[model samples]
Structure formats: structure tokens, C-alpha cells
Target: MSIIAVVTALALSIIPTGDTPTVSVQQGAVQGVQAEGVAAFKGIPYAAPPVGPLRWRPPQPVQPWSETRAADHVGAICIQPPANGDNAVGPGPMSEDCLTLNVFAPEGATEPLPVMFWVHGGGYVNGSGTADLYDGSNLARHGVVVVTINYRLGRHGFFDHPALAAERPAEEPAGNYGVMDMIAALKWVHANIGRFGGDASDVTIFGESAGGVAVSQLMLAPDARGLFAKAIIQSGVPQGATSRLDIATPSGPPLADRGASFAALKGVPADGTAEALRAIPAEAFLDPAPNFGGGDLVIADGRIVPTSIEDGFARGLQAPVPLIIGTNSNEFPWARADTHPMAQALTPEERTALIAAYDDADDFQGRFISDVMFNGPARWLARQHAARGHPVYLYSFDAWPDAMPQPHRGAWHAQERQYVFDTLSTSPWPTTARDEAVAKVASDYWATFARTGVPAAAGQPAWPALAEGHEEALVFHNDGVAVEAVPNAARLDLIAALLDRLKAAGLR
Candidate 1:
């Protein structure tokens, strides 16, 4: 067939054939099969190869192809240290040429659908948009266009150097080249989503864990201001960024600090530390300590971040968009347990030290960790956003089937995230019926929000916002979804106040 005929046929296949349909795009095309009436396009490249000199630099626009590019298999993941256990290959030998994205769109999509750009979470050090748990297929079938992207990771994505900066003085960025890559993807979306039948206006950006933190940063970024409209942050970070002191903001304490800023990364050799960072292989830069944490996340790099995110938000500098945010019931539990070198059952003495931190009379050590990590921080932020009168919807995914074994990772961090993206098969959870049920419910709620800003799903219990102190908020409980007074409200409040006092005293 001629190129025009091939392109025309591909585009036509994307249209509905009564109940059957598909769609095509440039570079390649997708003839999507309908799942509840939505079409999904998988694994599309958004930028030029990050290989060669582009490895540590900001992403550049994708090279346009003469023929439609086929997007069937997932692109290779951004370099990420592999999962520590069973899956540990330490990001399994990555390439500098990894800048790909996936898309999901409504079937027979002619009009511009609302766009929901998602950034995945791997503590800014690990994770890929291709993790079976993040398939945007089912999500696109829900009447929106979902785009998940890959950016540089660890040293390959976030490295800093003085030579490169001096070389690109007209385009010098402080670091956080990964975050900048995300912004570039959004800009690409804004420029090209129309061709994919996606609406540029009324975009809703959302993510969990590190991805949520990325969304939070996007909200604070002056450069990212007009790129999105609404945002959903599932267990996002409002604070606790490391080595950001190295960033040189136009104002404020440069995002960089100590000897680790992008400037420091740049100054490593010039400042005489180059022998250490450069002498080592790039992959060696992945220290095990941050253990998928943001110790190496976006820095203050004087450019994109401009200043501390909290300071920026405090100064009313964040994008004023509707925000839907929440956390699972067991974030802190796994954070402590997983990051440790030795996974030992806590001894009585160890347990006491753990529970003592919370001043709790109960023996649930898990609760203490959970409280400190997510519950404490999440409740405070919900209230703060509520005070600002931003439409904030808070939820707690406390439900896990009783059948899942002991030392249960009930609704743990990144656990609910799989469900939200409708990628249950990607997870190794015990495949009990309860797991399936929870996954469906969670996916439904997520899709509902992507469809409408509110996370209301039918046949489930009514989920109220944390807006009023009067109305109960949604709780995904063992008893199925319920509306509660923000689970353990009093304890959460105490933790919040305690942290506040400690912060005021320069202690926390």
C-alpha cells in the first residue's frame, strides 16, 4: 500500500466499527481493541535518544518519523536499580537513549479528550512507565488520554557538571534534568496532543509516591505553571528533599547544599571532587542508602525548582489547580522494613523503641511507622490545602483481604498504586478474590477522578472530602469502602502537632 493509503487505513481502523475500533498516530499506529469502550496506545517515544552526549543533559524533542511508528511493546525502562529482592538487577543495565512515553485514549476518539499525564514513582531512583502495574490501557478506555513517561535516573539522569554548564551557558540548568525532562514531555503534549485526539486544556496530572512528588514539584515549578490544570497526588511529598541545597535559585538558598549541588556536581572536578565522582563508573553513583529515596531527587538547581518547593508553595507560588491527594494505610511500615539491610522481626526492646516514638499505649508497632510516614504528613497537608479552600479529597486505602498472609503488606505504599493504574497482574500480591475486588474498586475510583476531578465511583460508598471537619472522609476499610472521620483522627492530629512543635523548635 502507498504511505497515504497505509496511514489512512490505520487511522480508519482506530474509528469505531460498531463495537470494534482502533486508532493510529505518526511514527506508528495502534489499532486498539475496546475494553469498556476505550482505546489505548502503548509505548510512544517523546524525545530523541538520550544516548551519547544527551545522556546527562535535558531531553530534546523526538525526531519525527516519515512513517507511522508502531507502538506495541513497552519501551525499555529508564535506568533504575532493579528491585532489591528477587528482582534485583539494579535497573538491569540501562541505556542513555531511554526517553519513551505511553498513551491511553477513548475509543473512536475524535474530539480532544481530557489529558492526564502520569509520572511513576520509584523514589526518583527506580521505576518505569512499563511496570505491568502502570498500563494506561484500561484508564484510557475511561474517556481520557493518559500518558506515562520515562526520564533519566540516578547519575545518568540527575548528574551535574561544571564543564557542561559552561558549554551551555545560554541553556544552563541547575540539575533535576529528569524533572526538566518531564516538563519537556508536557510541553510536547501541549504541542502535539491534539493530533492524538486529546484535549490540552483541562489536563489533570497525577502520580503516586515519587511520581506524586514529581507532580507536587510540577505544581511548584514556575516553568511548569501553565502546563497542567488539575492534579491528583497519591501519597505525595510536601517536604523532605535532600541535597537540594546545591541548586542555585534566582533567589532563596540555592537548591544546592553542602558539596552535593548541581553546581557542586559541576564543580566536582573544578572544586577538586571530580576525581571521586568521575573516576567511578556512572552506575557506581547509585548508592544503596537512598534506597529508591529522593536523596538524589530534584535539587534546588537554581533553574526549574527556583527555590525550596515548600517555600515556593508557602509564597502562593504553586499552580492553583484542583488537587486530589491521599495515602495508603501502611506507608511507614514498609518504608522502614524494606530499606533496612537486615529484615528481622523486631525484638521486644526494638519494638518498644519504635512504639515509644509515637507515645502510643497500643502494641501495634506497624501503626507507629505508618503514622509517622504517611498519616502524619498526609493529614497535615490535607488540612493545609483545605484551609486554602482548594478542593482537596483525602482517602485512606486501609482495605486488604483477610486471606493475605501474616506480616501482611496491607494497602502498603505502591501497593494501592498498582490498583490505581489497573495493573494488578504486574504485582505479586496473593491472588485472592479479595485482592481482585480491591483492585477493581481502586481502579474504578482512580478512573472516576480522571473522568471528573472528584473520585466518586458508583456502587461504592460515598467518599467525602477532608474539606469540612464535619463530613467523614473516604476509608477503604476491611469492611469494604466506608466513610469515616479520617481514620484515627485524634492520633493523626497529635502527630501533626508534635511535628509542628518540633519544626518550630528546629528539631524535626
Candidate 2:
């Protein structure tokens, strides 16, 4: 049936159905579920599918339809593997018809709601906004319009070619299509959110892991200016994390050469790369033989992503907006150590040796992973925003064993998702009575931050704006909120220097 028909029928069915009053928007209408103080609409399409010839090009406006598209079900994820995290969500369906988003807002017939655009994290290769971890219901319950979006991923989204660019001189550089998708979503929000009771002027863009990197990089994109009023960076920093084809210079294997690699694959053709990749089964593409390790997809396209975010932020170039950021105390243990039971049970000798190898290294090897993977980037973001004379809040999730599920060494990568959303049942983290209380506190703070510029809460400790040298940030732990300076500051500084040099060398 036509989407118009579906929407009309849906609208007809909503004749005073208890609480959730079905509403209409420019494209069509939706009957959202309402509870407490929030009204939610899931699977809303903000842009047209960039399929066939439109592939690799910038996003276009949503198709003008006579009827509303049925957004009850999430749109298919960009043609990529499903999330296989420590909690692997098995492979599911795929489609080019994947540009869709979801939203939650406080129920009110009129007036604009503050916007919180959420970007999910999956290392830029795996994951979707449809995941349970990003449920915007509770957040909307806190009084802002919360949105989660799915963008292109992996080979389908990041493949770049000089031929492709030449074919479309009007377009941005090919890789970072996923990032372009996000900019498109923000634009969509800017254009149509008011009809849904959202304030386009108060948008706060935020995300975790790769998503955090996306928000950070978006700061550098000229096109993203003024789309958001604030930013909440989680675990990502834009450093050497560029698309293979997007790098202007490189020192890796022969494969790093854009000309050479494309020349070698010339027989295959560029536009057809997507088809070739699709022809290969999902499992095979998950990891190729020589193993480049899931193939990083967020390349440094010259157009949408003009420069590296790390350099951009450090040069006083990030979006001048209020910012909030931080990471769990021991996120690596989840990404690395948690995968191995024995590793988590590090013997005294192992712990000592591990600490020795890392304890003194500038920022330690683990610190590099933590910083690049999630922390330092966050700190850098907080600093840049504060420098902009905006109120920037920095935090550290130190809830440790009390917040995590299973015996954990400390706060792990995804451990905060559940807490921030007050969702512990679904996340893999160990949850205790303390965990529940902590999660409530965490979610409450995030909601309050998104609602107003302040992350204040009732009976909760006051979070202070970040001050340079005075690196004091909020530490959310079982002991309740406390103020603590960013630990290992000197070590992180050393790690940053080493990484700058290594990235300069391009892994040679």
C-alpha cells in the first residue's frame, strides 16, 4: 500500500486512543506511544535513499509522498554487517533503503522541544541507531526531542575513487559518506523538526565511540555550522582515524596508495565497487584474509571532512558551543580484556608486568587506546568548547565493580550507555542496587544537561565547568558524584605526543 494510505489509516485509527494522540508532520503522520512526559516516534525517514546513481553523492530531501511512510519498523541498516559486540547482535537483513531516524519528545500540542540528536557507536564499521542501547524514550521522558539515526557504514558508505569523484565534481570527496549522512539528518531536523514540536535552534549533537568521532569531525565540516547549538562527545577523537582512500599522505603498506590501489583495482571499476562488495557474502566481508581488521570506514574525504578533527580542535576550530564529555574508567577492559576471561583475572605477576610495560610509557599503550578510542578526544573537546567561552562539563565514569555486571576491573567502554539511559537490564555491564541508583543518577544528569545547558540534578553533586590545568571533572561512581582532576594527565600528554609522531609517520 502507498505510505499515504498507511498514514491516513493510522491517523484514522488514532481517534482519541487514550494518551498518545497521533499527529501529522509535513511528510505524513504517525501515532506515537506516549508515557510519563514523553511522546515517541520511531523509524522516521529524513532523507531519500542514496541508491543506484545517487550512491556516493550527497543526501537529497525525503521523497515527496502523498502518504506517510510507515515508520513503525526501523529502516534497514546501511548495507553492512549487524553489530557483533561483546554482545553480538547476529547478522540481519541489509538494504540500500537505510536512511531513517527515530525521535522522542515531550507531549504538548504546541511549543518547541529542545533537540538531542544521538549518534550510535559501532567503531564506524558496525552498529545502528535502532539498537536498544540508544532508546530515546526515557530521554524524551526528560523533556527534549531525542533522535537516533542510522547512516551508511563499512564498504558501502566509505569507498572512494578518483573516478567516482570525477564523475560527480559537484559532490564531496567519497569516503565519509556516513558523516555526510549525519549532516543530512541534522539538516532534515533543521527543516522539519518544528512540525514535530522540536526546536531546531537548541540542537545538541552527541554520540559514543565512533559516533563521538563523527560529532567531533562534524565540528570541522563547514556544512555543519550552526546546525547544532551544543555538543556532547563521548569516546572518540579525530586523530589518524581517516579513511584509507581519504589520506593525502600515508606510510603503511602498498595498499595505502590511493592511485596504486585504485589502479590495481581499475579492472573492477569504481561505481561497481558497491556491487562487487555486495556480491560477496556478509560473513566473508566481515574480515578479509590479510586482516586489515574490519576496515576502518571513516576516511578523510577532503570535502565533507576537510581536515583531521584532532588538528582542527587543537587549532581553535571546533564549533563554539556548550559541551559535555567523558568516558568510563576502564573502557578498554571491556573492548579488550573482557573478551578474554583469563585476561580479566590478571594474575598479580601479569598485572605488575602489564603496569610496568604501560605504567611509565608516555600515557601507556592502553592509554593510547583509551584516549584515541574514547578519552583524550573527549577532554580535547571539553577544552575547546570551554575555550570558546562556553560552559563545558567533563566527567569520568568511575562506578567500577559496583556499576558493571560480572566482576569487572572498572568502568568499561559501553558501561555508561546503560547508566546514562538508566538501562542496565539490557547492557552487559554488572548491575547492582547501587548500579540502579547510579544509572538513575547518570541518566538524570544527561537528561538535565540536554534539557537545559546544565547537567544538574536533585540531591546530586554539582558538575563544574572544565578549567584548564584545573582539569577537575565530575566522577560518577557508587560513592556518589565527586570532583576529581583528570588522572594520568602527564601520561596522556606523552601518549598524545607519541601518537602525533606515529600518525605523522602513518604507521610506517
Candidate 3:
């Protein structure tokens, strides 16, 4: 068959047959499938394909369709490096035209339910909403509508070339296209989620790792205001070493310069134009070589992200919504002692004294780095929000499930996701009665928060909001979930001081 005929056939196949569940979104009608008391609408386009001229630009409205479109199969995920043995990318076809989202709602729901929109994390380079780990079925069954999205990844999603910036209209923002895509998705939800048995006005945006960072960024994003009613950030905080939104220096060369540098290594020009860069295949930019000055993921273009997170919080510019933010017990055990910022900033005597205070000499470096990078920032954010009178619930995930091969690493980064999503059966680790019990409690907390802005479950202890004299966190452990005072107060203070010194020295 001709290419046109093939495309037509593929489009036609998406339309659901008689008796399938259907909903009318802003763009068009989508037919979903029902199973196990849940209605799931998959591969629903939220925006126009970001291909050709649309590449690197803010997401545009998806073209409306007339006929009922099939939303049964998963959509293609944004272009990303294939996962190694880790199954990091999960399961999904790869494509540039991947601006789609999935919605899961309880079947036979007559009233609109709270919405939980999730953003998956892959170091800002990989991960997709279609990942098996992000299945929203379990969450939807808890009387909440769940949604997940796929945005651009790697350089295709976040490039900052002078030529591209100059070519665009002066009013348009440059860089951070991935974040722009997310804003567009949220806007779509605000306009259309009601049709899927969801309360558009009661949406809670939650994400892990890079997704959590996006949540933090969205809190301060002017355009994202009113898009989400609440936010949950897990194992990701916008402070310490990863705080800077713009990896490129203001006076430094654009990311294209680094691309040119990489091209030069391959016998190409050292300075390439925007048109020249665009003409290259998308896969060329996917090379894992050190390009674009290394750290140019999210740029603070004064548009999407107006200012530093600290400055925004200090100025009371963050969204006044209830927040849930916390980190795992062991964030990164492979960290090296010499690589930590405090290692270079502090004198030998100070470093010795700090390690002695922690009393875990062998693992002090990893613990200290984890605190400075993740734990400290999380607590600081909670305090900032509480000081501003916004209710903030904090937690620490110390539960090591039987599935963890490296339990000694403690409750490692991103481990809370399974429990929060109640997806332990799909994970590699063996599940115990306690694991299932904890998963239910964790997932209940999330669903409850989405419904009422308070993280509470029926049998779980009362989780207090962080305040001046009431600094506490709901500790999620395998033995039992309980409320406790914030852990490692003095050590966190030391890490905070070290970070201050580093920032003062312009080393951050």
C-alpha cells in the first residue's frame, strides 16, 4: 500500500467499535476501554506533534478531529536513548510526534473525581508516561482520576541555540520546551478532564526525580498558576548542586556551540547555523558525547522559569497550594567523597569535625551528599511553604521492600514510586504482607491528599503540617508508617551551612 493509504488505515483502526467507553475532550472524541472496574483512555493527543517547524517551540493546540478516535493503545514515547538492562525507559515505541497523555478513571463514576497527573523522571533525558511502572489503573480504582504524559526529551526537548532564539518572535520564550509541553498538557487537562469523570479544578500534579523537579519549577512558574491545585515532589528538590535552571552562562555561547564542538570532532564545522542544526537527523543529537556544556537541561529564560527557586520562594512568588515533598533515606550511595561540594569548600579540620559528628565515617560522604543535595533542600522547601502559611506535609521513605537487591543502599532514590502507585506486583522485588500493607497506606496518602490537600489515610497516624515548632514528617517504613520528628536535624543544619558557604563562594 502507498504511504498515504497506510496512514489512513492506521488512523481508522484507532476508532473504537460499538459499546466502548468514549469521552469528548476539547480536541475530539476518544474511545477508551474498560477493565477491572476502571476506564482507561490511552494515547490521547494533548497537543500538535512537535515535528518539523514545531520542533523546539512551545506546544501548539492539537488539531481537532470529527470521528471517534481510538485511545486503546499506548502512544509512541518521545525520542530517548534505549534503556540498558535496567528497563529504565519502560515499554513504548519511540517517536518525535509523542505529545500524548493517558487518563484512568473509575468505571460508572457519576461525579467528577480528583485528578492526579504524574510526570515520570529520567534525569531529564529519558522516561515516558507509557512506562509500565506508571500504570494509573490502581490509583484510579481509589476514586481518583489519574493521568500521565510524555514530553520531549534530551536535546530535542531542551536546546538553546542563538540562531533558533533569534529566528523566533521576540515575545516567544527560548529553551525549556519540555517544561512548556508540560504546561500545555496541564492546560489541556484544565479544559477537558471533566469529561473523563475528573474535576479539572482539583488536579494534583505529582512526579518523581526529574518530574519532581518539574513540579518544583511549576510551583514558581507564572503560566502554571491555576493549572494544578496541589503538588507532590518525591526524591527530588530544586536546590544545592542541581538548583540552576539555566546550565549555560548568560555570557557563554549557546548550546549549538557545544553541538558544533561535537560536530567538529566528527569533521564538521565548529560553528553551525540553526537551519543547519535543524536539518540534521534527530538521532545525531542523541549521541551521548559531552555536548552543549554538559549541564544545559532547564534554562531560566525569564519566561517559563522566571527566577531561581530560592528567590521565588523568598519573595513569596510560589503557588499557594498544599505541598508534599520528601526524599529517600539513601539517595546516592555511589557518590565519591572528593566530588561532594563540601569536600572542596570546607577545610580539613572542618570536614573531619563534620564526619565525626555524623559518626558514620565510612558512609559519611554519601550521607552528607544526600543530605545537602536532596534531604536538606526538601526540608528547606517545607519550612518556606509553612512560613508562608501554605500547608506542607513532609515524609521520609525508609522502607526497603524485599525486591531491593541492594537493601544496604537503604530506601534508595525513586523507590517510593511503586508503593505510592501500589505497583509492587509489577516490580522485580518480591512483595511481602508488609510491603502490600505499606503500599496501600502510601497510595492512600497520595489519593487522600489529591482529594483534600491533606496526606491522611484511614488507619495511618495524623500527619502534621510543618510549622515553626512542629517540624515533623510521616515516616514510611516496612514495619509501619508513622509520624515522627524530622530526622537528622543537626546534620541537615551543617549541610545547609556548607551549601551557604559554597553559594557565597560562587561555587554552586
Candidate 4:
């Protein structure tokens, strides 16, 4: 068959059949499949495919389709580094045309339910919303609509070159294209989620790791104002601010300089035009990819990411929305307690007191790094947000998998994801009765928070909001849950002091 005929046939096959759930979004009508009391619409295009000349540009409006497009299976994920042995890969093959989102809502619900928009984490280099671990059926059944999105990743998602900027000429912000994709997705949800039985006004943006960082970014972006009502940051950074767009930061060179350096490595001429840069194959950018281990994933482009997350919150410029933020107890169990840049700012007495506070020398490094990097920052952000008169709830995740047996020191990074999504069945480690129980409690807390402003779970302890005098968090462990004062206050205080010193010295 000819190319046009083949395309027509495939499009016709996707037309809604009898009993298939259909919803009319602004772009067009879509047919979704229903199972287990949930209506799942997959591979829904929210923005135009970023390909060829459109590459590196802000997401454009999705072209309207005349026929009802099939929303049964997932679309291709954005081009990213291969996972090798990692299991966090998304559902489809990798491609540049991957700006779609997935929606899961309770089937046949009359009233509009709360909307929970999720952003996946992969160090800003990998990951997609279509990962099995993010299956939203269970969470949707809890009386909420769940939406997960795929943004630009790696160079395809974030890049800044003087030539590229000149082409746009003060149009959209340069760099931070992935973040722009996110805001476009949000605008789509705000406009069309109601047709899917979701309350657009009650949307909550939640994410893990880099995704959590994005939640904070959206809270700071001026274009994202009033897009969401609540925010949750799971394992997000509170101190490590991102690099500036045109200006150098303590972290590294400005994004424009980095982009030029990358272009030089790619053999682009000093006076190369934007067309020459765009002509380079996408795969070429991956062979000698920019160091993925460090922090250049997103940039503080003045238009999109107006300021660093820490600076935004510090300046009280972030949206005064309800917040839930926390980190895992043992985010890095293998980190050795050794010299650090921040440690250089500590005095001998202060360093001794900090070490003595953690108690166990064998696990000193793990606990210390966790406190300074994750726990302490989480508490600090919580305090800042709470001080703004907005409701804030904090928590610590300390549960271990059965595979990692006792004297458990590993709540390791991102371990709470399975529990928060109630996706223990998809866990790589063998789960026990306690694991399932913890998943229920953890997922309940999250879904409950999305449903209402406060988090509450049946048969579990009430989660308290952070206040001036009383600061407590809902601690999730293997056995059960508890609400206690934020753990290791002295250690966190020392970490904070050291970090403040580092910032003062222009090293952070």
C-alpha cells in the first residue's frame, strides 16, 4: 500500500467502537480503554512533536485531529541514554517525537475528582511517565485523576547556544525546554482535565528526585502562576541551586558557555548558524554526552525558571501553595563519612560535634551526607514555606525492603516511590506483608493529601502541619508509622550552618 493509504487505515482503526470510553479534549476526541474501575487514556499528545527545525524550541500546540485518535498504548519516550541494567525504563522505544502524557481516572465518576499531576525522575537525563512503576490505576481508584508526562530529556530537552537564542530572538526563554514542556502539559490539564472527570482547580503537582525538582521549578516559574494549587517534593534538593542561563553560578559555567563548549566538541564552527547546529543528528549528542553525574540538567532561563529554587523560596517569591516535602532516611548508604567541600567551612569543634551527633561511626558518612543533602534541606525548605503562612507537612521514609535484611540502614534513594504509588507489586525486591501494609499507608497519605489540603489515612496516625514552635514529620518505617520531631535537629543545624558558610563563600 502507498504511505498515505497506510496512514489512513491505521487512523480509521482507532475510531471509537461500542462501549469504549471517549472524552473530548480541546484538540479532538480520544478513545480510552477501561479496566479495573479505571479509565486509562495513554499516548495523548499535548504538544507538537519536537523534530527537525522545531528542535530545541518551546513546545507548540498539538495539531487538532479530525478523527478520534487511539489512546490505548503509550507513545515513544524522549531520546535518553540507555539504561544498561537499570529497570526504570519507560514503556515505548526512544524517539525525539515524545511530548505526550497519560491520564488515569476513576471510571464512571459523576463529580469531578482531584487531579494529581506526576513528573518522573531520572536525573534529568532519563526516565518517562510510562514506567510501570508509575501506573496510576490504583491511585486513580482513590477518587483522583492521575496525569503523568514525558518532557524533553538530555540535549534534546535542554540546550542553550548563542546562535539558537538568536534564531528565536527574545521569543521564549532559552534553555530549560524540558521545563517549558511541563508548563504546556499543565496548561493542557487545566483546560481538558474536567472532561476526564477531574477538578482542574484542585490540581496538585508531585514528583520524585529530578521530577520533584521540577515541582519546585513550576512553583517558581512566572508562566506557571496559578497552574497548580498544591505541591509535593519527594527527595528534591533544597540547597543545590541550578545554574543560571546567561550568568555563571557557583555550580558551573553559564548554560550558554556550556552549550558553546558542547558545540565545539561536536565540530560546529565558531560562526556556525542555528541551522548548522540543528542539522547535527540527535544521536551525535549522546556519544560524548555532557557529564550526567553533575547538575546542568536545567537552567535558570529568566523567562521560564525565573530563579533558582532555593533563592525563590528564600525570597518568598514562590507560590504560597500547600506543600508536602521530605526525603529518605538513608538516601546514600554507601557514602563514606569523609572530607567534603562544605566540611572545609566547619571548625574543628563544630566538626567534632557534628560527627558525635550521628553516633555510629561506621555509618557516619551515610547519615551525614543524607542530613546535609536531603533531610536538612527538606526541613529548611519546609520551614521557609511554612513561615510564609502556607500549610506545610513534612515526613521521613525509613522503610527497608525484605531483600536488604536487618540492621537496616537503607531506605535508599527513591525507595518511597513504590509505596507512594501503591505499586509494591511492581517492586524489584521481594515485598513482605509489612511492605504491602506500608504501601497502603504511604499511598493513602499522598492520595489523601491530593484529595483534600491535609493528608489523612484510615487507621493511621494523623499527619501534622509544620508551625513556628512545633515541627514534626510523619515517619514511615517497616513496622508502622509515627509523628515525631524532625530527627537529628543538631546535626541538621550544623549541616545548615556549614552550607550557609559555603554559600557565603560563593562555593555553593
Write candidate 2's Cα lDDT for 247-294 as tens digits. Answer: 443434322344225433434443444444334443443443222322
- How far does residue 386 in candidate 4 sit from its true spot (Å)? 0.4
Give the poorly placed runs of model 3, Cα more than 4 Å off.
1-19, 240-256, 259-273, 291-295
* lDDT of model number 4: 0.83
State the lDDT at 301 in candidate 1: 55
What would the TM-scores of all predictions be? 0.81, 0.81, 0.91, 0.93
lDDT score for candidate 2 against the true structure: 0.66
Kindly list the per-residue Cα lDDT of model 4 for residues 1-508, writing each as its tens digit: 3332233334332333344688778899998888878888999999999988889888999999999899988889888877774555666588898999999888756556789999998888888998878989888888889999999988888787888877885666778889999999999998788777777778899999889888988899899998888999999876333667778866567776777778887888656888888888877766645553426768777778877888899889898899999999888777655765666666788677777777766657667777777888889889999999999999999997878755545798889998888888777778899999998888888989998989999999999999888889999989999999988777788777877777797776
Give Cα-based local distance difference scores for all models.
0.64, 0.66, 0.79, 0.83
Cα RMSD to the true fold for all candidates: 6.6, 6.9, 6.5, 6.2
Backbone N/Cα/C clashes per model: 32, 8, 2, 1
Q: What shift in Å separates residue 310 of candidate 4 from its native position after superposition?
A: 1.5
Per-residue lDDT for 266 in model 3?
46
Model 2, residue 185: distance off in Å is 0.5
lDDT of 3 by residue, 246-276 (tens): 3545435545554456555544454555666
Give the clash total for candidate 1. 32
Among the numbered candidates, top lDDT falls to 4
